[model samples]
Target: MKDHETLGERLAEQGISRRAFLKFCTALASLMALPPERAAAMANALARSQRPSVIWLSFQECTGCTESLTRSYTPTLESLIFDMISLDYHHTLQAASGFAAEKSREDAMKNFYGKYLLVVDGSIPINGGGVYSTIAGRTNLDLLQETAKGAAAIIAVGTCSSFGGIPNARPNPTGAVAVSDIVRDKPIVNISGCPPIPAVITGVLAHYLTFGTLPDLDDLNRPRSYYGTTIHDRCYRRPFYDQGKFAKTFDDEGARNGWCLFELGCKGPTTHNACATTKWNGGTSFPIESGHGCLGCSEPHFWDAGGFYTPLSAPVVNIEAATLGAAIAGAGVAVAMSSLDRNKIRRAQQAHEKLTVKEL
Candidate 1:
């Protein structure tokens, strides 16, 4: 319903109404943690400037990353994907295939060389000389490396691509490795999670589109604006934990009262992510808020740190038969105390004992 132009100019020409554009700006402002005025400026910038080109690469991973993007219903990511920017390559979403798909990627890479955003959603397995995955007869590793050669910035979309997800877990028979492992020279912004929140994914993209750079990131390469604080810090049950009130079991009265889940092995204290705040399905609710403990899904090595049912710090339980002889070291001292108590029942003995002790 609007004429085409640079993203900046488009915002300027937003003939629909200020209500819609202002709403979009408000979303951007909240995500960026910027003031309203700043958000307005960001909106103007996006509406006036040319939309950036994004090339999404799907490698050895499930389509969960794409699924997350599709779940972004507000503003309808379909609108953003189709109207906001030029999505030149996406194997799952694109209608073209075979040589047409490969050429589409190649053409876009050449046309927008060194200026397009590269989004990857899976890790590259370097086993057997990186031949595990091949697209268009080229290995995913080779394709990633080659594509990175001219990309402006890289976005590692899912946990699989960001931190090797489950593929790179212990033993790692496939020898899976993240994008950062192979594409070391470029600037990478990692959005790590099995399926990262839709808002988070779009927020980062919108921030880059508005500001022309990556969003502020934490040490783990996740956007600090979203993942800076641990889930426990913002959790509703935090007060209960501080008060030492806890839920002993899943279906107990404590749970009914929405008491602290710490005793139930909540990992929110150590795990960092925006689940508590930016919840899935457009800020509905997170797992912990909905009668479930946090699984610490966003953290690296989440699958191996411990089990979902295991306590965050379970007490040591050693029940060998060898400790039976170690519990009776003070029997003689107990008998001596009993003898002294019996002697104290005699008044003359009590007084005499006190006098003798004093003289000694």
Candidate 2:
């Protein structure tokens, strides 16, 4: 593959039809919440643009992030767009090894200079002179600083590189820190998740490729398009939650009926991500749909946010007291209120919404 070849040229050479390419761009545009009209413009921009050089660096990670991006059973648009990039240096995917692999990284840095994208996964261990993790002869800290110097922008993939993930969890043995903590001079985008949704990863890359600039980001430096709304807002079980119907146990009747899992430690109410909409496994289903609560893997310090099975906040309404009086007095209320009239139900729903808002 040549660096000067446009993405459309590459796709055409590989026998992918323009219609298929346009369909992919439309889907990507929708995922990014762009206007319908923007899809055609995006397609045109991306078709003529040269593939950007990407250097993916791995530090103290489990490789789950890489697996999430590459393990799709079929060749979807995400994989195709990923392939469109000039991945000049990737430890796991590159054919070179040992000194040759190191040389490739150096060569890319020299050739692309300040025009290459620097992608990082896993936390950087700065403890013990950053000896907990090393590549070739240099520590991750040294390498990140060196590579980040000439990067057009930095993309910290996964919670590990974004928020210091599990390696930076309790006990703090490694003194692990996120990419943002180390490289302050460059523009950084954090795509946070235990292993981010594959589409979200490609969506960010696609936005950059089409616009030649980073997308609008939230306070956490995450793409606001994907992380703008909380999972609870878009969850299918939200109606159940609003009605105060919840599952007490995994095998309970409420659970069997697809009721809300908020009481069972769902962090959807507070955690923000696109899981509820974009879903996983090619939009087949997300964790909440599989009869489980959201793990809130996208939030910072989620591992230390408390037990996964614990509720986000104490039960806002108690299940023992059963009447509008309980709701008015701000006391405990029943989970099921089938006998309530329409007006009473509306008041109860408003009460619940108010309390949940305060908690969030």
Candidate 3:
């Protein structure tokens, strides 16, 4: 693809219809929670805009983020959108290697200085002079520092890069640190997930390509559009949680009946991500849909949070009894539970008063 060619021209050359392109933009707009009318504007802007150069650097990660983005189920639309970017360097996907590959990266940095997007996956280890991870005899720390200087913005594309992920877990030997920890000067957007949803990654790119600015981010620097709501809030099993029907074991009756997985160690309540709604495998299903609870892989330090099978907190009441009561009286039981708690406090106060009177 010629660097000068607009996305529209490139798509046309590839025989991609404008209607399909518009559809993709509409999907992206919906994903980003943009107005319906904005889809057309986004499509137009993207079609006319120059493909921004992207330098993807992988460090202390499992490459799952790259896998998620490149191996998307909707390979046609998603890959096409991916191709819209002038990816100057990505060791995982690029064919060039050794000096040739290094030269390409250097050339892109020089040519698109202060304009190219820097996409980093994985944490950078700082221990032992950052020797834990290196490429081309240069430490990841050094490479990140060098590359970040001229980047227009940086997209930290996984939990590792965003928040130091598993590499920064307890007793970290590598002293892994997030990209934001090192590159403080540049604008950074954390796409924090074990491997962020493919559409989300692309949607961010689309937003940048269309508006020339990053989307509004949450406190964690994650795009609020995707990370604003907790997974439990959007999970289909939420009704089960509210009703107190929980699966005690993976193969329990409740489990088969699609009860809440909270008891089985789902971290949906505290984990903020779009996985519940966005699903995976081309919107087919996410982990919860397959019977396993959310591992809360999107959040920071998830690996060290607790045992994957351990409940976030032990249930205050027996799941079976609460489920039965809820099933019998619905919201009334909830109200009664609240009243009972107040009654218990009132009894305790009365007992305290009696003891004080006796003492007096």
Ranking by lDDT: 3, 2, 1
lDDT of each: 0.75, 0.82, 0.82
Model 2 misplaced stretches (Cα beyond 4 Å): 72-83, 314-360
lDDT of 3 by residue, 67-93 (tens): 998755432444544556888899898
RMSD of 1: 18.2
| Each prediction's RMSD to truth | 18.2, 9.0, 10.1
Q: Which whole-number lDDT from 0 to 100 does residue 348 have in model 3?
A: 30
Worst 10 residues of 3 by lDDT: 347-356
Say which prediction, candidate 1 or candidate 2, comes out ahead on TM-score: 2
Report the C-alpha lDDT of model 2 over 186-251, residue by residue, as the tens digit.
999999999988778788888889999999987689897897666876789988998989999999
> lDDT of model 3 at residue 80?
42
Q: Tell me the spans in candidate 1 whose CA falls farther than 4 Å from its real position.
A: 1-5, 8-15, 314-360
lDDT of 2 at 325: 61
- lDDT tens string, model 1, 24-143? 778778866677778668767777666777889999888999998899854467757755777888989999999999998898899889988899998899998778888999899889
Task: Supply candidate 1's per-residue lDDT for 80.
Answer: 71
Error of 3 at 160 (Å): 0.5
